[model samples]
Target chain A: MMSTVLAMAAKDLRLLVRDRGGLFFTLAFPFLVAIFFGSIFSGGSGEPRQLQILVVDEDGSEGSSLFVESLDRSEALSVELSSRVEAVEQVRRGKSVAYVALLPGFGASLSHPFAGSPPRAELGVDPARGAEAGILQGLLTQFAAERLQDAFGDPSGLQENARSGLQAIELSGATGPQAEGLKRLLTEVDRFATTQDTADGQEPRSGGQGGGFKLEPIRIEKASIIVAKNGPPNAYAISFPQGILWGILGCTAAFGLSLVSERTSGTLVRLQSAPIGRGQILLGKALACFFACSVVSVALVIFGTLAFGLAPSSWGKVAVAIACAAMAFSGIMMFLATLGKTERAVSGVAWASLLIMAMLGGGMIPLFVMPGWMQTLSNISPVKWSILAMEGALWRGFGWDEMLLPCVVLLLVGSVGLLLGTKLFRWPNA
Target chain B: MIRLAGLTKKFGERFAVRSLDLDVPRGEVFGLLGPNGAGKTTTLSLMMGLLEPDAGVVDIAESGPPTDVGVRRKMGLAPQALALYQELTGRENLRFFGRIQGLSGTQLDERVDHGLEFVGLTPRANDLVAQYSGGMQRRLNLAAAILHEPQVLLLDEPTVGVDPQSRNHIFDNIEALKAQGRTIVYSTHYMEEAERLCDRVGILDQGELLALGGVNELIEAHGGLGVLTITTEAGEVRSIETENPVIALADWNRSELETVRSFEMERPGLERVFLNLTGRTLRDT
Candidate 1:
């Protein structure tokens, strides 16, 4: 029986070597699929887009000019000048992410403020790009608030007034280190106020003068950017999973078709007639299919790593994952072939199953973009688990804890498929 | 010896073979003669244990035909289809099958050479089967089947689609096997082959055996009288009655039918006997 199985497997291997076209379709096609999809997901050539914002300067005051100068230093926004109508048009057309419209207000309003209503700035933005637009709007609003305080010359006056009021209350004796810290903070504010006046080219105001206020310079230090400790987010990372999924699916289809051909050609019937048991014959063919799938998987992995820079942290784990995946696919394919009585039917079912699995398993699209329900539903597909397990081992830097679930799922699916396949598999046309 | 008793097989609603009973004695060439779909192939399949019988038993020698490994070791089957791998060379295919049948190393190489030589394919033994002609491939197919040198050989339409030269070579090989005291059960639709080779022939039709006997017995039973023909000039004609007309006519018509262009006589061939029993020409069906 062992000899019969070995003989059958050897014959299939010989046939595979003789037929160049079959070898290519079985072994090389998967790597081609990987390269094709890898290129698409890696974002091979397009430049990244930057946010564009239009600044409308209706407030012709020096304070507004300072605000515009501050906006020019922002790295997040590419600022441009335009009329309200032009800015609104640009925002509506998506040419600019958002428009900053300064309302018309003369310099006389700030000199005689009565606090009836605060001035308003209008921001025009497209809703589709609303999130970024909103963030930019918040940043600009804070800038405007700072500029308004600078114009009024009372940025720290409110803090100083609160401190004096608290001192006057004297709820407890002000003899502790807390009182000394408060005094030090007040003196620093005074020094900042003095510097602000000199920087603005204004004379210092007297301490006891009526309606006198001071401006304290507050320095806003932007955060030092912390670059992420990883390679650039690539489209290939996503494409790699897709390629692996398709590669396994292709192996299943290719091997299933070969089995169907053998049945049609009467080679399988002849094998059955030999002094071999049906179980031995089926096992022989299954082993051949498994070997073919493993070859294809190896080819795909080599090409993926070399051509696309897809490096797996653990080669051993990746190999095991690929072997399990190939075996699972082989089992499913052999089962599908047995269910079919003809080559056409087997090919049709194999192709349809492959496409369906590819679609559901994030082969063509990333699972992150899929709806939660659909993502959950993908657990039923072996392609999904296999891809996830392979990606976890190869690209994702996942430890065994993270990788264990997908591997277990894939193995379970493989076992079930093998059980059903062995039971369902028939010799030739049954 | 191959023996089958009450062996039967059915496919779905159709009974392919029904209670087939026969014994192919050792050292004799047994022929199974039947038209297409007449249970000949089905019975062969059952006897080879390729298909499970719906009823009864099939045995080779003392054992049965779910033939044990020991019995399988002593049996070789040449199915109708080309069973040898097309991508392997003739010798390689023989060696592979021989190994599967338990031969190995030097023994395997020797058997492979002998098998290829038996089918007169030793010269082309190293050429791939795909490179061989249909007749050469058919011969190689037979070679692979007989590579293990089994005690009994089951050949199912072993000469189909072969040129006459190759067919004669195959027949010669079978005769040599028979001469070596090897039991053989040969199935074919060729009546002339049955007449020339078989020690006993079983005529099967519609899943049932219509007749079973030696060549001469079958002919004498179905064929009422012998036939004799003598072609001569218009003026020379004569009628002669004798059980052995060909021998008697040679002496009688040596001078009388001297102007004869051709003369032939036979105790009616297997074809005639088949047509007489089945009421239809073997070739017509």
Candidate 2:
């Protein structure tokens, strides 16, 4: 019986090798996808990537130019100057995270503490990148606040601006209590500015609490949870997990389709006529799918290690992950085979179902990048467990204790699918 | 030897095989003759243990039901449909089937080669079956069935669609197997092939066996009479039905030898016997 099962599985493997399209989906396509995504995410260096933004300066004044320079000097931001239309276009096209456009009154508003209107900066940001928009807004506010600090540092400029503001208010001809209050406030500001300027050899109160007004800059220190020595060597370590899922999906679809083809082609009837039972037949199919999955996944990991600097902390854990993933997907293959009768029908349904599983399971996108609700939903996907198990060994530096959950989940999923698939299986004529 | 006692199978309200009782003794070539829906394939499936009988048993080699792996090992079936992997070569298909049948190593290789040679597929053994012609595929199906050298072989519609040459080739292969004293059950709707090869023929209709006996025995019992035609020199034609055409012809020659320019005789065959029993031609059914 064992010999018969092995023979059956061997035959399926031989057939898979001869099918060029199946072979490509099973092996080559997954590798190429890994390389493509890995290269994109690697970013060619270990340094943290800066949030890029475009700056549009309509004010065209020293104050506005200085603000732009300060933003350009920020380590967290990479600024590019462009026209308003071009800046918005770049932000819309996802070439830049957001755009900062300074209006015409920005320069004058920066010099005059008591001005007609405060400086205005319009932000055009990508809707999909809502997180980055908040960060960009915070950076813009910090740079604008620095201008206020500069105004306080030089009281001579403040006094001159205050006298011009008071003259303009008085010439405008208003006699209301509110107008009297504003004039009185400007007169006090002029007196204070003159006194501070007249004080001899006094250094600027850049950090002093003068006149009960002082701006304290908050310095933020950056850090990472993933230790450099234990973290992934490159993005390929992260991408190969998703790539392995694609390979497993290919195997699942191919094996499922092959089952329907066998029935339609009458080869299944011939198999039944042999001295093998139905259980053995299904087992043989699952074994074949498992072997194919394991081979494709192992080959992908090996290629990743050699070509893309994927460094798994533990080879033995990697093997365990591969085995569990293969087992889970083989069971899935069996379940998928029962979805339809004809090869065309089975192929359509299997791919649609598998694609959904892949999408939810982090086969298409990295799980860490998904939203909170999506990550919670991913727990239901075998792909999530597969990737988690793989990442644990490859770069997450998860010890055996931490690896228990994913392995157990994978095994449970495999067992359940296998049991259901076996119960639902039907012969060609049945 | 193969025996099916009171074998019954049904699909919904329809009887596929009703109370089928059959026995093909050792070394006999049994032909199961039926029309499109006459339960031939169903009966074969039961014999191969692919289906369970609703109310009976199928015994092969007098050991047990074919459902038992040991009993099934003694039987082989060539289904009407061509069963093969198109992606694999003819040699690979045979080898795989052989291995599943418990043949391995040098023995497996030899039997695969022999089976391919027997099917006239040796020259194209290494070519993928997808590239093979329909006739070649049919031949390979037979080869796969007989590759294991089973004690009892069941062939269902072995010559469904083929040219005359391929049909003859299959007949020769069956004859060769029969000569080896193997118990063979052949199922087909073609009466001529049955008349040519089957040791005993069973005529079936609507899931019931209408007649079962030697080819001549069934014909003699069910066939009505022989038709004799006499054509005179003046082109006058006369027809006579008789039990003994040779005796009738002798009397006609003595009485009116010169008046009869030429004569012809038509004997009752399986076709007539089937028509006589079913009230409809086999092809019509």
Candidate 3:
């Protein structure tokens, strides 16, 4: 039985190799896509892209000027000083991704121990540039966290206050006012320990009658950004996995169409007439498709590694992720093959579906840059899970624990599809 | 030997093959004579266990129903359509089917080579099947079926659309297989091929067997009359059907027949038997 399966698989592989069109889409197409998308996202050297952020400092204070200088020195953000109206207009016109504004008298607000509610920086951004806007917002928040923490007087002393305050709360096991405030402070201290505090999310306050300043929380104009101290991974590292997935999908479409072709050509009936079981026959075809899809994915990874310098965080995890993804797509091929009676009908439907899946799954456009609703909807795409798994393996530093969810989802898809395909499978005559 | 005991199959509301019973003795050459929708392919599929019988069982040589792997291994089928992968060489396609039939090692190689030689495709075995002429592809399809040398061979109109040369080549192969004492069930719409090859024939129509007997026996039993075609030197042609050819010829003018440039006399064949039984041409659906 095993030998029969292998023979069938070997025959399919031979045919797959002979099919220049399938190979072209499965292998070469991914490389071209990777190059095109990767080069567009990165300069192809795998270095992180510098986000251009225009700054208009209306408060001619030392602190405001210092903030602009620091933005220019940061590795991720490229800052340009511009007038408020010009910067806002540039963002509105799509000329720039975002602009940060220093509200008037921002310097005295920070210099005095909270002279009033800490002056907020007005961040005007173009929503179309969601990814770049996210990064710029994170940078601005980090800067704000640093200034807020500075208002408390020495960093070590503040951290000591936060650390001991947490110990007091723990020892007391109390829901007292000091502990509640300290719990929030400890969360802030954790952020502070990493780099700068969660300044974008910090609470600022005006100086009350007390000798020290009371912090008041300031909002940064509806901006929501999570500060990643390690910064974002290089764009190619992100784009290459999507390219590999496109290659896998291409093979899935090819193999799915091949099944319909086999039935139309009557070879499927010939195989059914043999001594092999239906399980063996479908297994052989599934194995063949799986191998083809896996090889395309692995080849793209190798190309990305050797040529584009994509160093995945863990090779073992990537292999497992790719295996799961290939299995899912192979099962999908079987399912789609059974959907239509004719070869042309199957090909048309399968390609259209795969293209839509790719579009929604970050194959055609990056999910990060899409609108909020679109990004949320993309979560439903299996391609998104595949991309997430692969990104985690490559640059997200996803260990097996983090990789298990996508792997499970992918395997579930494979199992369900395999069941449907097996149930619905038919020969040309039968 | 193969047998279908009260076998049945249905498509939607209609029965494709209903309560069909058949037996083909070992080493017998049985041809399924039918029109387009006569359920020949459905019966073959059920017998191969590629499809399940809706009501009854399909048993082979008392081993078991065709669902048994051991029984399945004993039979081979060459479908009406060419089943070879166009992208693969003839050798590869033969080798693949050979391996599926449980042949491997040097045994697989020798059998594939023998099949290629038997089908007269050895010279071009290395070429892709897409590049092969229609006749070559038809012959290669035959080779793929018989590479494992099964005891029972089911060929379903193996030369449906091919040039005359290819058709003749296929005829030769089928005849050779019959000569080898392989129990054969061949299906086709062509009457002459069945007349020349089948030791016994079953005429099927509307999902039922209309007639079953030796070809000559059927012709003698149901044949209406023999057809006579005469062509004059002026390229004019005429056809007549008569029960007694000798008397009919005697009644005709000798000079008129002498002027006939070409003459053909077709004896009662499967086509005539089918027409007599079903009152429809073999090509009619």
Candidate 4:
């Protein structure tokens, strides 16, 4: 029985080697899908992708240069300096997500902090990047707040700006009740700066801290919730799971088609008539599909590791995932074969069903990007579990207990599929 | 030896094989002659245990049932269709079947080689079955069937769609297998094939056995009578059925019957027997 089963599997492998269409779907197509999606996710690199933005410094002053430098150093934004015209053109053309421009008088206004037009700057964002635009705006605000902190840290500069502002106001206007109130505000501001400068490192006096008489600037500290080790090293680490899913889908369809072909061609009947149990035949088919899926998966992972820096955290866990995934998809192949009696019927039904599974399983779109409802629906797809299991070992940094759910789901689904498929399968001409 | 007792099979409302019984002695070549839908293939499948009988039993030399692995090991079937992997080379296909039959090492290699040579496919053995012509594919199918050297060989329309040359090659192979004392159940619609090859022939129609005997025995029993036709110089034609066609022809010449012009005689054959029993030509069905 073992010999017969081995012989059957060996025959299927030989056929697969010669089937060009099957080879493409099983091996080449999945690689292409991985590279395509990986490029989109990682910008084709190991680092997390940054939103590209252009900066136009019209003043080119020390303050404007400082602002540009701050934006350039941000982890979320990749900044490039350009002319205002060039920056606007790039944003309009969708080349950069957004651009920031600093007009003249921006450097002079930086001294007053809140007195004049508040460091005049223009933000031009690509309309399509509404979400990213909000992030960019918040980052610009944070950098501007740092400038305010620099102003508060130097009380002498604040006093000099207040004295200049009061002299200008007195020369431009005659005295009235409103003028008297402005004059009172300036006198108080001038007094506050003088006291802060004289006090030198002492805590600010209590009472006049409100109404533009500030004490200290607010600073925001940022941290990421996701642990560094738990995230993927590159997009390939994430995309390769989908790639393996594609390969498994291909194996399922190919083996399913082969089973129907054998039935229609009468070879299956011959095998049944041989001195082997019917169970041996089904086992032989399942083994062939499982081996094929495993080989494709391992090859894709190796290629991804060598070419794209995809690091699997645990080899033992990787083996578990691959074995379970292969088993699940092989059983799917059996069930698929039993769906129809003819090759054309089986091929059409199998591919359509697999494509749907692929769509739901995060093979077409990443699970993180899916809508909440779709993500919940994906739990039912074996593809989702297969990819989840693979990702857990590869980059998700899942411990053994964390990995148990997807692995167990895969095993249970496989066992059920194999049982149902074998039970429902029929030999040809019977 | 093979035996069937009240073998019956039904598909939906149609009876595929109805209450069939027969015994094929060891070393004999038996023919199951029928038309396209006459249940011959279904009966062969039941005998091979590929399908279950609705009622009755298939006994292979009284070694229990054909469903037994030990009994099945003694049988080989070349089905009506070409049951082969087109992508694999002929040699690869033979090797696969040989392995499935539990042949290995030197024995497997020798059997594969001999099977290829036996079917005259040795030269094209390395070529993919898809690349072969229909005749070559048919020959390779036969080679695969005989790779295990089973005691009983069941061939269902083995010469289907083959050229005359390939057909004769298959006929010779069956003869050789018979010479080696293998029990063979050969099925075909071609009566002449049955007449030429089978030691005993069974004629079947509509899932029922119409006649069963040697070719001569069937013809003598159910072939009716010799037919004699005479066309006279007066443009008159007469068909006379008689026990002796030669005697009838001599009588016609001796008579003053419009000065005999041309005469012909039709002797009883399997076709006549089939027509006599079923009242329909084998080709019609």
lDDT of 3 at B110: 99
User: Would you list the C-alpha lDDT of every candidate in the order shown?
Assistant: 0.69, 0.83, 0.78, 0.83
Write model 1 residue lDDT over A1-430, tens digit each, in one string.
Answer: 6777787677676777777776666666665666676566444332323456787878877645666777777765567889877776555433456677655552223322221123445666643243354466567756655655554477455345434434543555554454444445444445665555445654333333243333322222211110121121344545665666666776677667777777776666665655667677667767777777776677667776777676665787788778778777867876787778788998898888878887787777665445557777877788888886776666555567767777777767767766787788776524
- Regarding TM-score, does 1 or 2 come out ahead? 2
B156-259 in candidate 1: lDDT tens per residue? 99888889998898889899998999999999999989989999999888788888999888887876566566666665545454578777667756666366
DockQ for candidate 1, please give it.
0.29
Estimate, for each residue in A96-183, the C-alpha lDDT of model 2 and write its tens digit. Answer: 6667888887877776645455677777764334445557777877877787767656788768877987777777886665556666
The residue pairs found clashing in candidate 3 are A145-A199, A203-A216, A203-A217, A204-A215, A204-A216, A204-A217, A205-A215, A205-A216
Candidate 4: where are CA atoms >4 Å away? A44-227, B229-238, B255-264
lDDT of 3 by residue, B108-164 (tens): 999999999988888998999999988888889888888888888888888887889
| Model 3 segments more than 4 A misplaced | A43-109, A113-233, B225-244, B251-266, B283-285
Q: After aligning candidate 3 to the native by TM-score, how far in Å is the CA of A309 from where it should be?
A: 1.9
Tell me chain A's TM-score in each of the predictions: 0.58, 0.64, 0.63, 0.63
Candidate 3 DockQ category? medium
Off by over 4 Å in 2: A42-216, A224-227, B228-240, B244-264
Q: After superposition, how far is residue B195 of candidate 3 from its true place, in Å?
A: 1.6
Each candidate's fnat, listed in order, reads 0.34, 0.80, 0.86, 0.86
lDDT for B123 in candidate 2 is 98
lDDT of 1: 0.69
Model 2 chain B, TM? 0.92
